[model samples]
Target: MNDDVTCISCPLGCRIHVEKKGDRITVVGHMCKKGEEYAIQEVKDPRRVLTTTVKIEGGRQCLLPVRSEKQIPKDLVKKCVIELSKIGIKAPIKCGDLVYKNILETGANIIATRDVESVEKK
Candidate 1:
């Protein structure tokens, strides 16, 4: 199988061509080592940092912005979001607070991106 991948490892976006045959792989068109590494890993296993909003109770906003501390498997992004959607957290939440830990056993923690102050009680 032959595939083209755009390298996102640096400012220069090199279009890398990768060819996989049985157990052998060949990469071309990369300008740097980072690009080459990116192409290889992208083809083998892709990962991405997840960022989304979740339900927040008694806060300045109706939703709290959250993100994974590290990149998780790209395939599990949707599942992570679906799980988060079912959770509602109470404020006040500080930035960098741990919202969820080891999400889906991907070794990535969901953390609050911004502070959410608690609303005054009536």
Candidate 2:
């Protein structure tokens, strides 16, 4: 099968052409080494860094922004989101605090993107 994938490794967004035959794959049309590598991996196994918010209790905001520390397998993205949805954190949460460790055995921790201070009762 032949496919075209836009490389997102850098701002260039090179349109990479990929050809797959049985067990072999070839990628072309990339202007940089990183783009070439990205295209090749994208064809083999695509990955993405998951970013979303989880509920936060007793915080200034109702949700705490969280992100995966590393790019996760594309197939595991949904599962990761679902797991995150089922959990909530208590403030005071600091930026980079561990939200979930080794999430879904992906060896990536879900971390807070910003600080969440505890709300004071009047």
Candidate 3:
């Protein structure tokens, strides 16, 4: 069987044809250097930047924008987001604060990308 795909390296998406025959592979259709490399790497392993919000304690909203420092497995993004949604961080959270560490053991922990001041009750 052959799995032909495309490389979205730049504005010009190059159509790539990846033929895999039980560990043997062949790639074609590359416009640039990155296109070919991207196609091959994607076929072996695909990744995407993880961006989502976790719960917050003293913020007006229950969540804040947080992202993994680096791109992780695309499949894990959804699972990470769902897990973050259930978390609640305390107030006075500074940017770069560790909201949750060792999340999913992806070596990428959920952090506070924005600063939140603790609301003082009147």
Candidate 4:
């Protein structure tokens, strides 16, 4: 089963035609090196990085920057985002701090992409 997909690998956004017969696959309409690999992997397995905010204490509001340590399953991104929304982080966070451990069992943790300092109250 093959499907056509537009390549977002670059600004060109080339329209790709993919055909699969038995175990073989063919593709066309790619204009860059990134798109060729993208088409091959798209026909194989598609993955995307997850980025979202998590609850933080002592910040301007109550949220901190968070992201997956590595790209998890693309299908799992929504589930992960839902779960991440439930996470609450205490303030004075460090960059690269482990925010959530073994999230989705991807052997990856949601980490603090930036430090959120405690807001001094007047």
Top candidate, metric TM-score: 2
Q: At residue 40, what lDDT does model 1 achieve?
A: 90
Q: In candidate 3, what are the lDDT values of residues 1-122, reduced to their tens digit?
A: 56666776788888898778888777888877788778777878887668887767776556777878766787998998898888777777788888778779888877778877777731
What is the model-wide C-alpha lDDT for candidate 1? 0.93
* lDDT tens per residue, model 2, 18-108: 9989988888899988888888888788999999999999998899999999999989999999999999889889999999999999999
On lDDT, the stronger of 1 and 3 is 1
Please give the clash total of every predicted structure, in order. Answer: 0, 0, 0, 0
Clashing pairs in 4: none
Candidate-wise lDDT, in order: 0.93, 0.92, 0.77, 0.82
The regions of model 2 sitting more than 4 angstroms off are: 20-25
Which residue pairs clash in candidate 3?
A: none
Model 1: colliding residue pairs: none
Q: Stretches of candidate 4 above 4 Å error? A: 120-122
TM-score per model over all chains: 0.82, 0.86, 0.69, 0.80
Worst lDDT run of 10 residues, candidate 3, spans 113-122
What lDDT does candidate 1 reach at residue 105? 98
List, residue by residue over 39-67, the lDDT tens digit for candidate 1: 99899998888999999999988999999
User: Which candidate tops lDDT?
Assistant: 1
Tell me how candidate 3 scores on lDDT: 0.77
